[model samples]
Structure formats: C-alpha cells, structure tokens
Target: MAEFLANYLPAWLAYMVAGAIHVGLIINLVAVGALVFIWLERKISGRIQDRLGPTRVGGKFGWLQTLADGLKLLTKEDLVPGGADKMLFRIAPYVSFCASIAAFLAIPFAGGDYPFIVQHVNTGVFFVLAVLGLEVFGVILAGYASASKWSLFGAMREAAQVVSYEVPLGLCAVVPVMLAGSLDLVVIGDVQQGWFTNWLIFHDPATFLIFWVYFTCATASVNRAPFDLAEAESELVAGFHTEYSGLRWSFFFMAEYGSMFSVSLLASILFLGGWNGPLPITEWLGLTAANGDIAWYIGQVLGVINVIGKAVAGVCVMMWIRWTLPRLRIDQVMATCLKYCTPLAAAFFLGAVAWQWSLPGRTFFGLLESPAELQSVSEGWSDATAAATDEDEPEASEDQTVSSEPSRKVAAAKLTGAAALQIASTNLQGGK
Candidate 1:
C-alpha cells in the first residue's frame, strides 16, 4: 500500500502514512485486546467460583461490561498524593504502555514473501526482550512517585522478579533461535512450517522441557499469578499503581494485558508454529504465498486468525492459572527463577546443542529422516554467499571455479552453531 502510494505521492509521505497505519493497527490491537481480556477474566473467575459476572451489562453475556467499566474509569477524578512527584506520577503509565506496545513493532503476525510485520527487524527477539524489560522502570517510577511504602515495596519486588526471570526466559528462547538459525521471528516461524511435530517444542526432548521453562518464566515476566508477588492483593493494596486512579489506573491495566498478549504471541511465534496450524489446512485449500495476490491475502488473513487464536488460548490458560493457583511469596518467586528455572533452562540449552550435534537431520526420535530439510534451512544464507562471490569474481574462468571447490568446502566446514546443524544434518542424511 505504501509502495502503491509512492507512485503518486512523495516517498516520504507514503512511508509516513504506512507507518501511521501500522501504529493504528497496533494501538487498536492493544486497546481492544485488553478490553476483551478483562471481560474474559471476570467471566472466567465467576465461572470458577460458581457465580454470574457482569450479567446486567450488554445483555446476558455482559458484552459491554468492559466498556461500561472504561466509561466509569474515564469519568472518575484523577488523583495524586500531595507528597508525590507529580511529574513522574503523570508520565509513568504512558511509559509502561508505550514500552508494551513498542515490542509489537518487530513481531510478525504471519510469514510469507511480504510478512505481516511492522518493522521487520533482524534481531526481533532481542529487541522485544529489551523493550519489555524497560516496562519495570515505569513501575519503579510509579511506585516512587506515589510516595507510598506499599507501592514502593511492590515495585521493588517486580523489579527483582522480572530481572531474575529474564535470564531463563532469554536462555529458553535461544533454543528456538538455535533451531531456526535466525533471530527474525518470521524466519523462526517459517522454519517450523510443516506438521505440528515440526514445532520447536517437539524438536527434541530438551526443547520440550524448555517450552515449560519458557512458559514459567513468561508467566513471571508478565506478572501473572501465582508468580505475581508484585501485586498480591492480600498483602499490598494495589501494588505499583496503588495511588493511581481513573484512566491513569486503567492505563496500567492496559499495559499489563498488552504485555500479556505480547509475550503470548511471542510464544506462539517461537514454539507453537506462529501462523501455521496443527495441520496444513491452508496449504491443502490452495491458499498459499505462491498462488497470487488474492490467495496470498486470504492465506495471510487465515494466518492472522491462527496466530491470534493461539495467543488467546495462551491468555485464557494464564487466566485459569491465575484464578486457580495461590500467589507465591517474594522469596518463593526469586527462588523459582534462580534455583529452578535458570539452571533448568541452561541445562536444556546445552542438551539441545548436544542433541543437534548428535542427531541432526532426524525428527520424531529419529524415526523420520529428511536431509533436504537441513539443506533448505541453510539454502537462504548459502545462496546469498554464492551470489556475493559470483558478483565479486564475474570474470573468473571455468578453471577458477574448479579451484574454488576446496575453498567452498572449507567455508562450509567452518559453519558453526545453526549453520553447523544444517551441514551436519545434510551430511548425516547423505550418509544414510
């Protein structure tokens, strides 16, 4: 669309318009997604406790309950403590909300020649983690600016918990990056493009274990119970946002739910095959990237549905866990991260590396073999290298090509990590 507009309008204007569209989409996603999750949480909690929740609003199902709550919040008077740092207090929620929403810029919703991504950063995984880590700073600011001891304690706990969990979270996420050989989320998702068994969670025993560890850390990272020691209602009043009111308070919830969805979507892309369903229904229906624009568009729409459905499912599971489990103490939260999750994640990372070293080119406990899979994985990089080499030595004779084989082999042999995995897989499959 931006490119289309560029044919008539200035290139700068076209780019700006495209960027605005992307920003609008993300903003709506975060805002509307938070509304739905809030209502869903209320309904789920009510059902678990054998009671009706919000039955009066928007008919029997209470569809307008969240909207009604939003209105009420909007109408409430904004308040700040007299002793509070008014400047920091005023800006904290927006900071948290912006950080939460900014992570989506690099997250791709679908995979194709033109993926449904905003920025398409090569280092998307790291970018998201780094941005998400910044959210805690807002919490700290909110707590300190509130001039409340309870809020300060909550913020400190949140900082400790989030920082601790991020170690294992990064380690666990690296497992899929190692498998896909790219930090680009679209590439990660595309690499797992076949059966559900191809998903990173099923890649090996270590990865299977790593998935659970990732979820645990993810839960903690998002401040969901039983890991939500930062906002224990029985202990602290309302945690970091205790002194906030009206839309300001609601902004905090929006940031929370937005972060929840972001991490859940990240999990989908990393481990659950992103836009790919458990079965190849879209492929069978002839809706694919290769089938022209209409088919590609339809495929992408379906991909969006697939990815969002998985993310919603993850959010619902978190809600269930929140309502069912008891909250952990701060000490227990730190212990869970340091003593268990970190060590387990590190072990699984090593185990996955070793497994890839030993079993390359095999899947499903080595019952299936496909050497071409590994070749396909490395083909993108290999082709780029070949193209660059060809461009640099266009005048080389056939004799030079023959002489280059040994150097090419040496280069291939020097491949390490994911590249090594691909080469080893190819060799093992060839030997078979």
Candidate 2:
C-alpha cells in the first residue's frame, strides 16, 4: 500500500491540482475580462455620447460597476413567468454559458513548444467553430420558453441571424486555416513566426479583406448592436431574454460578453500572429534556456501578454463600432452578410489563391519568408540526412521487422498526424 501510494499518489495529486488551477484560471479570465470590458464599454460609450457613464462606484473609472451590477442581480428575486416552460427557461442561461466556456477548451492562451491551451486538439479549428454554433441553441430555447410573443420573435430572429452569418464566418475563418496549413492552432501560430506581415491577415489581399468580413460576421454572430435586430429595443423590447431577470439575466450578458471575447480571440489567432508579436522579443532577448526550462516560462508570459493585447484591442474596436454605427435593419443585416460579406470573402479567397500561385517562394511584402517553403526545405533537409544515415546501416528484412498491435497503433497515430499535416500543406498551397 505504501509503495503504491508513493508511486502513484504524487503524479495523480499533481494532475488534480493542475486541473483545478487551469479551471480556476480560465473562469477568472472569463469573469474578470467580462467585468473589465463592460466597464470599458460604458466608459467608451459615454464618451461617444458626450456623457458620464459610471462615476462614483469604483473611483475614477467606476471599475466596480460590474461588481455592483453582479451583486444587484444576485440579490434580486429570480422570477418565472406563469406560462413559461419552467425547466427550459431555468436551464437556458447555463446552456449558453456552457457553450461559450467550452470553446475555450482548445484555445491556446499562450503558444510555444508547450502551449498554454486547456486541450490541444488536432481538430481544434472545427471543434471551436462547431461548439460556438451551439450557443444559438440556448437562445432559441430561451425564446421558446419565455411564453411571450416578443421573446419568441426575438429568439427566432437571433437564431436565423446566427445561422446565416455563421456561413460567411466559417468561410472567412477557413481562409486563415488555409493560409496556416494546420488545424492545430499551435502549429498555425508557429508558422506565423517573425514579422506581422507573416500573419494570415496579411498573407494576401484576399485574406486581408476576409479578416474584416470575419470580424463583421463574428460581431453579428455574437449579436452585437448594429446587427442586433434580435434585441432591437423599439421593435422587440428586450428580445429573447425579455423574461429573464436578476442572476439569470446577468448570466446571458456574461455569456454574450464571453462569446464576444472568444470570437475576438479566435480572430486574433486566425488573422493576427496569435501569441506571437511582430517583434520576436522572446527570441531576440534570449529568454529561452538551453534546457528549455527558463525560456518556456518567459515564452508563456510573453505569449499571454501578446494574445491578451490583441484580444483587448479587438474588444475596443467592437465597442467603438457599436457606439459609432447605427443599427441595421434585419433585412439589411441579412443582405450585408449574404449579399456582401460572403461573396466578397469568397472572391478574396480566390484572389489570394491566385496571388499565391503567381508568386511562389516569395514573401507577401518582401519582409518575411514563406512559411510553407521554409518548413518544406527544413524537413526535406532533415529527412535527407536521416535517410543517408540509415542507408549506411544494414536494412532489416521485412520478415524480421514484424509490427505488434501497439506498434501498429503508434504507426497509425503517426500516419494520421502526417495526413493532417499533408492536408494542411495542400490547403496552404490552395490558399496561396
């Protein structure tokens, strides 16, 4: 018992502790970032309207306004409508929140040899995109459960808006995945090393334009104003969430802001250089250690700063747009997404493809190297050397080199990884 406990307990306990830490950190990020963004939004919106937003709550910036709001929501009575579907109504906000939180699972907060991701999935791009779509289900259920005509209308509108906009958003997102040549976000980030011009947004003219389309679609998808006809105050009152109050209502807002940040973070990864900045400060400063001990820590710190900086910038831009732009009508919103954004994004994708084909072995702006060619050259050289070294030794006969089940499984995993890498390479070629 003592031997077993000594052998297994430490590692098991460490894993449990690490898991707890990661969950706590992620929860804090979502909760705290939401509070900060809300405060910033109020302050920015106030300035735009030439009025004071929050003054006394948390001193100079009213930073504690969200905290106060949270307390108010918590203290308020949780009410249910007489005709509402009780179970669904009660469960709706949590559903939305869960979906929003789940997408963060595969998101790399810091990218490096060992990324600061909760789960490093091979199909991370598809997984995040798929789960993000689930957020609409909660809204739909909320609208239906509210037992109000206005709420139902708002929910249906929101559902339709998200469904329609998602098409273009996916397309726009694919443009970056195509450029990066990998669904593994860490690999994508790694490929964009060096300068900002190497970022997918600047990969080509089409991608550059597609980035805007992605941003617009992402904003609309998250039900931000201008595209927020679902919650049009004059038209639908409080929209799908009309029946919600107190903590329940607050949860919906939290989910919204959380998703807004998630999409922005996604945008930062897909278009920007993710955790990598234009300057390779970590590399230039030699923050990495020879044994990859100290360097990894410094790299993670820098990466976190880089990704957060980009995400905050994205949020600020969204707030600015919200304050500056007038709301688009539902019809106009549909037209902008389908008729304008989709077609434009598609055309840019093709243009980028043509540009890449026209200019092989060349950088986008003559400042950075083509990541594809660089990888290919490096891998080819390494493989050649390995093959040459192997040739000097006697080769094992086919009969002598038998593969076991575990070995076969290992081989299969390698093959799958290779296939994914191959597909990524092909997609990058096409994207160019």
Per-prediction tally of clashes: 0, 2
lDDT of 1: 0.80
lDDT by residue (95-174, candidate 2, tens digit) is 99889888888888777667789878976776787788889888989999999988887886777678777767766776
Clashing pairs in 1: none
Q: Could you say which candidate leads in lDDT?
A: 1
The Cα error of candidate 1 at residue 36, in Å, is 0.6
The C-alpha local distance difference test score for the whole of candidate 2 amounts to 0.76
**Candidate 2: misplaced stretches above 4 Å?**
1-15, 289-292, 372-432
RMSD of each: 11.0, 10.1
User: Candidate 2, after superposition: displacement of residue 413 in Å?
Assistant: 29
lDDT of 1 by residue, 1-432 (tens): 699789998999999998899999999999999999999999999999998877889999997999999999999999999999999999999999999999999999999768999988987887897798888888989988999977887887787777767777887888777667667788888877767877777878898889889988899998999998777878889888899999999998999999999999999999898999888788898898688889989999998999999999999989999999989876677677767887898799788766665666555445455234333433433434446554543332232233224323332332222233334434643664
